[model samples]
Target: MALGREYFEPSDGERAFAETGRSGRSRAVQLLLIAEQLSRRDGDELPTGLREDAEALGTPELRRDGSDALRGEQRARAVAGTRLRSYDAGLASELWSAARAESDPGAAIDLLGLSLEDPSPYARLSAILGLLSLAPPDGSTSGVDGYLLARLFDEQYRAPNATGGLARDLFDLLNGPPGGDVPRIGAVPPAPLGSGPLSIGVHGTFSRYGTSRVAPSHKFYGYLGEEFSPDLFPDETRFFRWSGRYSRHDRSKGARDLPLWLHSVGGVGELDTVYAHSHGGNVALSAAADGVRINFLVLLSVPPIERSLAEWAAIKQNVGYAMSLRSKLDWVILSDLVAGRTRGARDLLAAERSAGLDFPPEADVHTTAPLGWFSHSSWLDKRVWQSTTIEAEVRNKYLLTHPGSP
Candidate 1:
């Protein structure tokens, strides 16, 4: 390995990473491995510093991936993916308990997202409860899913969906019978949009959880995570006490985003990914046409909050800021209005007007693409509201079908 490293080969690093991933790997060994993997990229030679770290068996991977962005990302994903598998297989829970009780809560947080997927209900519930024990999301104690699931799973209770009208069967499973006691843990899941007449699909901030700055690696999946819970309210508190189209519908847990008939959409690999997505939805973003007003918009990732989005609020204060203008070209979206192929929410309204149709003023519909952006921005394009249905029959069916539901 030393000779290979001296020769500056990428395979040496790969081999080192694969070996250190095993259970007995030391903190130093694993850390070096993580760093090496993270700093890697296609056709690129591994850095000597990392190679030296590998040979030293120095420490566990530290902080987040960075500096050498691609490699950093690689390492983070590798570590996350490996731990994720272990947790998925039900090993991490046993180790987590030992680690957490021994004053290594930080490690516990590292493993929390993976822990949520554990097979043992206790293991999963225990992990959830453990997260709640820490600084809950915003320190609110009200809508704790750990306690809620623990209690619901224990007491046979279910939160009714205020919009869907029908409740999910998973309700009783979560709300029923007391499982053994598990300490609460975890950050609170963000609140569901509140149960108000205007809340359903209501256009608002696209970045709800601050997506950009929030490290994607940190959002790793865990047993019974906040990700599974829907915040009916925007504040990231107050559970809606009801499920809706947002959560899995038992009828079609295998399918996603009903578009009437779409088995013929080409691209076998993409189709398989959509069909196989655990969440039953496509995981990648897709669109048609180019320029300011694209034909259709389908954001595979839910419109999430990014670090850069906080500025949108500030920009929107008067018109020159980055925030989305409602319509009629506030200074922020003027380019989109004139270019007709701009970014930001107002572009959506422009798209609508182009179609010679306007939504009722009360509907409050809007778009969220940014116009004329620098190449360096973290979240260049989060969502562009532009899906179209030429068929009058299909459009009416969607709005009318969800009549009682939000």
Candidate 2:
């Protein structure tokens, strides 16, 4: 059977656009709603009254702001042409300008081809939206459009921070019927016998190094078992790690499964902490939103949050404490910018200073002192594992939970 009606409810702006033909909403919101409408054939076609609205946006609307006005006009033309099923004479020039400005000339050319040569602008727009929905983070065909697409999928579609309306509808549409498209990440196989208080590491991006190689296990476990003695961790402080292959892979799937993975490997109700790096940090954040419990959360070069800071703070409080170690490394900046997630990252770090009653007391965010050497990949170095900072943090957290013994 098809999905239920509850899956698709138009937002107020969408309703306004449908009724009055104009909502004056942010162009991003308008574009998203239009894309969602164009994707489905099950609904009625655009009604008669929307023709003027479509036409209004069909041609560029230039104003005093100039460049800003031009950009808005470009987006509006695409939206209008999509809605009205046609474009004005000047579309070829505009499309060429947009293409030349694009970093991915090939993808831009393809888009231009579809926008100009396709008989139906609606179909062309739908294709653009679909590509945006399915676009990978980097590699082939990646640039501004790809970045924007990935960000849209992460921030607007998958994240809990998403406000409902047409965005939600589009997410539901592509997500498929419940239990259909999304794979059920099976529980982690049981840990070995006598698994004690655990220190789990979640790695970002699958590599030849393989899954579950959080740290050189020998370093952490060896220190606990041989160097530090058994009393602190009991049975050598169980070490576990997990990684979802390839950073490009959709994270929501692995994210949904992480809590269960934690439960399986560490045992539900097992007290422990997790150190997640890069996109692994994103997965940890997702698990936290699902109410996963841990003694502490240590994130290294975590990306930005997809939801509101208040919501993130509330989620963070579920753990004993959250310690974020951020770097001003150019790699993270360029990568996040290219990934179209710089805004989310900025918002997440800014939450540290957010004044209000809603902020959680347990949050402890740590940015590197200016010019700190840590990079997004810094955690991979064995030196970081041996560093006193990490050792102190882990030792302190253990002491806080256990209290009496050193």
Candidate 3:
């Protein structure tokens, strides 16, 4: 029987397998199914290695399904894929630059409209950021083409993809009234350190967007609990809740507030570890860069922005041990890059050709090549937390080991 099919549309046997174990071929089959789905949805060719694996494993069902998906994608691509394929890295950069440079709002809107049409997802993201930059404080995109703005709003409403909610948030930022109170920084009073080491969790953008607090039951906190089991975690675990706004201002403020919050409940010295996901990693690193000491810092799918690189030395010095876990399929980081560029920060792609160079030399970077369609938030999945790969890296390798152990 094809394990991939059973995994996707599980029968009693598949359900029994899931309850029994999640290692070896079972995990592989699941990953293959995920990869096939991603290829079908994203219109990208399946990687050769995965294709070979499917063949070797003799998963005829997966092979047939993947082949059919690829053929269907190819047919669909004939009409729309050409435009996306045409926008190479150089062309996408040029489009973004042109959009940024245009002084006239109307002309800039036109350039952004063209960028939105590009095949590259990054180019499309740049266009979204461009629109955000052009919009007035009151959130009006007046004089801009109504259809383009309507499409953006429609994406916000429908959220057809992962980035849809992000587009919605950006739209809300443009049209929503401002004047919310600034987040308090350095006001947390210092408290006594209790027994055992303390662990803190910080969430990424949109996790608590426009919200004043993150509920105790948020999935982020649950993921952290799974990552750091009760045996490893202190009795009094804390979470650093932020505005979750995807802006430089909010991130910088979060960085400053993290250290102060640490100070409030014992001090950075009392902290055992910090597990930050997505842009929350940026906040953690930024705080470390500013001389906040941490025992262990685990970054999950964090974007390697230039700002982090610039502060590499400080981060390395202050952090006892740093590890970054990223998925090969994470497009959210790419979107973060565009958002960073719109806010006038330097681009990482401009400085380094690969994601490996984004971190400091001393920091341990573990890139996971899961054979599935995982997204930015997929890192928080229970299956990911329990996987053998994650167990090796996060549990046995890092968490169980002493700080600074290789």
Candidate 4:
């Protein structure tokens, strides 16, 4: 079915099933619900296997009662199925695991496509990552169905949000020529650092999919440079472009490469500050953990994944000063909690904190919610940059001060 439909409310039986602690049975119900939802969306009758499973599971609420009760039964069944498919965290985790484990590319593609409808942003993010993983190393889209490719593009245009933009870029990569492999550690040589304090911008994940110059994240970096460079930084502002892929492997490589690149330009001591958003922040922190001592670090909505806690903790020792700007309404980091459950413990302990991630005690934390900036990308907004509060923080407090003066 076309995505972005209103979420269905769960019935008493469905809620009871979830609370029963029968994980195996719950998964079966979830699959049945997903099958039913997909079948109905495709204008097809309910599949026999799903119907049989519903009967076997004794989930009468998920089966059509009778012809006379068609409307009510359909509603109940659909609601039950939608709840299991969309709202169940365990189910979402299972979907990701299944997509990763599936051997057949075609089956894996179908599973990933279904996962896009999940309410958890992590699941949707995983789906996009799975698609990229399935793409041919040679950059050919030969095995993928043309209709599915078109549908993905349609979803991208319809949503037009962060995840949508990511999907669009992935679509471009699938359709276009191979961009070649991700760079190795130290592959990118350091450019000349001009005479004054240097400020560097590193963009978040999915940014490397399309042209680096025109990406929204890149544009945001450009805006920051133009808006603040003249007064805040007398020297030069530059962007450090990395793979921007959503994987530990790529991020670890970036962490190593960032230090190598900076050292070539006279090390992090020469850097006045580094501004990074989302996973970009992780890269910077990971670099600090690897001994890149930074004068200042500004993190925008970086997720506190369990694997990155050590890097976050390292900031106190490796960074002279750190500032984190976050929005309370940033759902992307919440997705990290949901998706991280599959990996291990959830890193962010509290949901009420800035960006849902905990920062070191030495770090300065600010929430954009009071400024009416709620979206994950609100920090990138020109209005946020222009606000008096942010002006005081960035211009007067952080940037205007000498390096290491928090």
Separate clash counts for every candidate: 68, 1, 2, 0
TM-scores of all models?
0.19, 0.44, 0.54, 0.49
Residue 285, candidate 2: Cα error in Å is 2.2
Per-candidate local distance difference test: 0.24, 0.40, 0.47, 0.47
Alpha-carbon RMSD, each predicted model = 23.9, 17.3, 13.5, 14.8
For candidate 2, write residues 187-251 as lDDT tens digits.
Answer: 33444467666555666643224332344343543443343224223322343334343232345
Q: Which is the better candidate, 3 or 4, if ranked by TM-score?
A: 3
lDDT tens digits by residue: candidate 4, 1-406: 2212111122222342244342322332333233233223124443343344334433332222233233323323323344355455545454334432442222223444555454443334444333333232232333233433554576566654565765565455445442322454533233345545667766787566534322334565567667554322222233366788655556667877775666555543435567778888878877776666666777777765433455456655667677777654244553332232220111212221122345544344443332331245657655555653765676554543464544
lDDT of 3 by residue, 1-406 (tens): 2323212322121231233232222322322222232223234433443344434433222221234334333323322333354423344334323422432222223334444444333334435454333222232333332443455576665544445766765545434443222354533333355545566666778676422112235554555555453323332235466677765557678877776776655554434677777778878877777666666777777776554455677777677777776654344553443333221222212332113214545455454554343245556555655553665666654543364544
CA displacement after TM-score superposition, residue 403 of candidate 1 (Å):
35
The residue ranges of model 4 lying beyond 4 angstroms of the native Cα positions read 1-80, 83-161, 164-195, 209-223, 230-238, 263-269, 307-313, 343-355, 360-370, 399-406
The 10 consecutive residues of candidate 1 with the worst lDDT sum are: 285-294
lDDT of 1 by residue, 1-406 (tens): 1221112212232232233233211221232233223222334443333334334432233232224334223323323454435543333433334332453424434444344444333223323332322322132333333433443244222222210111122233223342221222222122234422111011111122333211121221110022221211233232111112222122122122222112122111111101001111111111000001111121221221111223323222211101111211111111111111111112222212111112122222232322221111212212211122212322333233235634
Candidate topping TM-score: 3
Q: Candidate 3: what lDDT? A: 0.47
Model 2 residue 11 CA deviation (Å) reads 48
